[model samples]
Target chain A: MQIVLAIVIGAAFGAVLDRIGATNPTVISGMLTLRRIRLMKTILLAIGTGSILMFAGQMAGLVDVGHMSVKTAYVGVFIGGLLLGAGWAASGYCPGTGVCAAASGRKDALFFVAGGLLGAAAYMATYPAWKASGLLDGIAGGKVTLGAVPGSKFDGLFAISGDLLGIVLGAVFVLVAFVLPDNLTGGKTPAEVPAE
Target chain B: MTLDWKLGGVLLGLVFFAAVLLVKPIGVSTQFVILNGIVTDVVNPEFITQTDEGYTSTNAYMAKSNGKYAKNAANPVNYSFIFVLAMMAGAALSAFGRGLDREDKRLPAIWKANFGDTPWKRYAVAFLGGFIVLYGARLAGGCTSGHMMSGMMQTALSGYIFAAGAFLAAIPTAMMLYKEG
Candidate 1:
């Protein structure tokens, strides 16, 4: 039953990703280059909406903060994030979107998926070495919010309330999503801009 | 037809909400790890169990039966894996419905425009990049969807920090790779 639900939910999410141009490598790479802003707006808007819903749901008891799997803060996490970013820029596909693109019948995306799997396999093969390297050690707050805020039910880095801060930040993202131009340089449709 | 991004974003947010309501948070990287576990277990069950250290520890989620690496389809991690399959099906459905798969060329035009026409180079870079991203994601404990999107939604500090780091590197990397011709 749960697997069925997961399939439905995943399908809906995938459809959304495709519709928003996320399945397109050009759109992703273009956003990184600041040549296209549509994907950026989409991402920001999604994050904003998600933030509002999640935090608001928590306040309303509709969502459980404990259910969310929060990652620990560590030096390696930051460095790894940088590497992930560089990889995304170079490959034009993150893990999620790569699968989506492949499903959309892009052969290049298939290669990307194969590469990702191989890469992951390599990582697994060397898991012990990485573990011993101390890069994965040194966790900073295991699960934190903003500012180590007080009177807050959730963990954070700041002294502000988690819900309040999340909602405010979400609103800001929504605003920015609306404010950014759909296309930075303009005039060409997304499809027309690439591979004529 | 492509739905507007704002609407798509809203729908995606709703999906996240639904995921939280029904199961654990949404993420993609762990599925790969689970796959790795399956592969390794098949190749040599003793490989992962040889050293009970770090992630490879016997009690680790991937090594245990009821854990993320469970071969059972009903397992939660496997459910996440199923979710990835479902995502692909969803994208394929959308593409077919929209005639997106009708295009003859598989290679992205932007890549060719910038890097010239060499399939080998493109594939090589793609494989290397994919490997690095997965490696980094494992080190970081998540990817954009896991750490940045869902993490931020939960107001986790690591999410924001990871987001900052991702953009800090991504923007510059794109600039360096795809300069104006």
Candidate 2:
């Protein structure tokens, strides 16, 4: 039953990612460079919107706090994020987007997948060193949420209601997506592209 | 036809919301490690072995989590792995269904403008980029999906912190590489 759901859910997620032009390297590159933000706007809006819904669902009793999975906080995760960002800009794809792009017939994405697997293997080969480095040790009350929910095992960083916090943040993203212009760097819009 | 960008965002959010609400949060990068484990097990049979307790791996990392990782590697036909496979299928269906992602125009326009059309170079860069991203993701214990996107949605502090670190590096990196654009 879960496997069937995974397929349906994964497909819907991938289809939506492709439809939103996430599978396109150009748009991703454009967004990162601030040359174009059509995709960035979409991303902010999506994240924001998702935040609102999930939190709202939680408030409405439709979402369960127990199901919420909080990743452990550690120094290495922060450091790793910096490294991930550089790669994202250079490659124009994150793990999920990269997979989707490859699946979308982008031959380059195939290489991306290969590289990712190799990278994972590399990490696996050296996981002990990192673990020993103390970077993986719990930080900032590891596995904590911003607000205490009624039932989750994770701690809360603040006494404020997490659900409320999510809605506000999400609304801000949606607002930015609306107000932000299509192009930030004055790149050639589709209409402005020189004819071949 | 491709959905409008804003609408696409809403839909994407809804999908994520549904996933989180119904099951677990939507994450994919961990599967990369599982993939590596599976392949590693193939080359070195002793890399992973079944035991009375359950599956175990010679590698300490896999052996952690009480052999859960090792179990998944030994039996790759699990939920998350299958989800990843399905994600690819979904993208293929979307891209190929419309026949829109044609081969000839594979190289994106901005890339052409910045770095002439050299397929191999792009491929190499992509490969390097993928390697770096995955390595970092593993170090961070999540990727854009698991960390940035899902983390932020759940209002986890690490999510915000990770987003900061990511953009702090991403903007400069993008600016450095995409000078032409």
Candidate 3:
């Protein structure tokens, strides 16, 4: 029964992604070019909404934060983050988006997948050398969460959370949504863009 | 011909449930192990020694290593493969419903002109891209599906990192390759 439900959910997610034009490389590229803000808005909304839900769930005792697995601290993660940011700007589609794009039968997505697979294989082939390095060494601290932060990660994070930082940043995204000119937009919905 | 959002929803739900029921959970990162195991066996079969009672075969080795080298790896007949297959089927079904599956001659023309008009380059690049992502996924210990979707669902910090890294990588890569005419 659960299995059936999962499949349905997965399929729906794909459909929503398609409907949103997320599977399109142009849509994603538009976010960076400021030609399309829909992707950014959609992504921000998803993240913000999901975060709020989880926060509320935890406070209400409906969920436990302790059970979750967290990565040990690594400088590599930060470097990887920068590389990823650069890659996305260059590629236009990340893994999920790439998969969806491929499913949609888009040809460009084929290259995206090709680049991704090569990157993965390269990482594996070089893992032993990397693991031996001090930079990638793992710290003992495990299961860290936002609640532990002295300054909230959410703060200045689009500015809507009651928490001062969250409210500030959360609000920025909303403000950007409202104030940015259509051309200068950081994110927009699929309906806002011209069709490919 | 319109997408039945409800049907898409049902298929997604089935995939997740099927994964949990049969293979513990759904995430694309695990596929790396299967690929890795295959590479390992092919590259150096002598290194692929039997470690457990249930999985004493090469096939078992492939699945087990892919799943965090988990002992008692989930059955090969699990839903990950099935879910991917179903996704393709659903996409095809939706395309057919929309009358959009018909071949566009121009599509091939674009590919021929840009991608060297050779099958080998296309396949090689595809394989290389897959390899890169798998490597990153392993280094990060998860993929976008595992770390981003599942990880964020659980609110793990690493999930955020994974998501950030993936999006970060994707945007630039696309621009470099796809921005041209």
Candidate 4:
């Protein structure tokens, strides 16, 4: 039953991603280069919308907070994030979008996927060394939410309810998405390219 | 017709909401880990059980119990795997419906324009990038979707911090590589 639902939801998510031009490497790279803002707007809007919905759901008791899979913060995560960023700039596809791009018939994306899997395998192969390297050892906070802070849910950082803070941030993202020009810095829109 | 991203974002949020409501948070990195486990199991059955020091297994997550991979509640071939497959199917369907599937260009225009027409260079860079991304994602315990999106939704501190790191690196790295030529 759960498997069937996953399939349905996954398809819907993929379709949305593709529709938003995420499956196109040019758009992705363009966003990174500041040559285009459409994809950026889309991403910000999606994240913002998701953030609002999630917190709202939690507040309304419609969603289980425990179901949220929060990752642990560590020095390695920060360093690894930098590496991932460099990789994203070079390749133009992140893990999820690479799969979606491949499915959309991008041959290069297939190679990207192969590279990712091989990289993952390599990590597993060298797990022992990495584990002992102390890079994975220092964990800052594990599974902590804004609500966990004292005084108020969002009092720690910005001095508001954590959930409200998320919503406000989300609103800001959406606002930016709206305010930004379609071609902020001007670049070839996907429509300008001849269909292959 | 291009779908409005705002609409897409809203719809995606709803899908995510429904997903969390019905099953669990959405993520793709773990699927790779599970795939590696399955491949390793097939190549050398004992490799998975072997420990880093022979006393403690290097990958306890891949350990089997009663002839089944016992870490995640949903087996590799089950939930996450199927979800990935469905994502592919959905992308393909969308492409087909929009008549965008006819394009057979093996390389993206921007890549070819800036990096030159060589296929090998493109492939090597892509492969290296993919490898590094996955390695980083694994080390960090999640990818953009798993940590940045889902975690941030719940107002988790880790999510914000990770996002900060990702953008902090990604923007400059991109600028360095694809600088105006």
Candidate 3, superposed: residue stretches over 4 Å from native:
A63-69, A139-142, A148-194, B1-30, B33-50, B53-67, B70-74, B78-134, B143-155, B159-181
Model 1, B75-163: lDDT tens digits are: 33457888988989998888777776344135676677688777678777777788888888877889988998888777777787788
Q: Ranking under TM-score, best-scoring first? A: 2, 1, 4, 3
Off by over 4 Å in 4: A149-160, A183-196, B48-74, B101-104, B179-181
TM-score of 4: 0.86
- Relative to the real complex, the DockQ score for model 1 comes to 0.60
In the order shown, the candidates' DockQ scores are 0.60, 0.69, 0.23, 0.58
Estimate every model's Cα lDDT from 0 to 1: 0.75, 0.83, 0.48, 0.71
Q: How big is the positional error of residue A27 in model 4, measured in Å on the Cα after superposition?
A: 0.8
- Model 4 lDDT per residue over A101-185, tens place: 8888787788889999998877767766766787776454455666542322232333456666767777887788788876655
**Per-residue lDDT of model 3, residues B1-181, tens digit only:** 3223334333333443333333333465455454445455567765344555433334432333343342222333344534543444454345444443223211322223344456455444444554455556656666655666455543445666666676666655544554322
Structure candidate 4, residue pairs in collision: A153-A162, A154-A162
lDDT of 2 by residue, B1-181 (tens): 5577778989988988888887888889999989888888899999999999998898887888889989998988887888888988898898787665354236656567778888888889889999989999989989888988899888888888788888889888887887664
- Docking quality of model 4: it rates as medium
- Give the per-residue Cα lDDT of candidate 3 at A186: 40
Evaluate model 2: give its lDDT. Answer: 0.83
Across residues A92-189, which tens digit of lDDT does each residue of candidate 1 receive? Answer: 88999988988888877777778787777666666667667886664555678753333334465666677778788889888998998866665453
Model 3 chain A: weakest 10-residue lDDT segment is A149-158
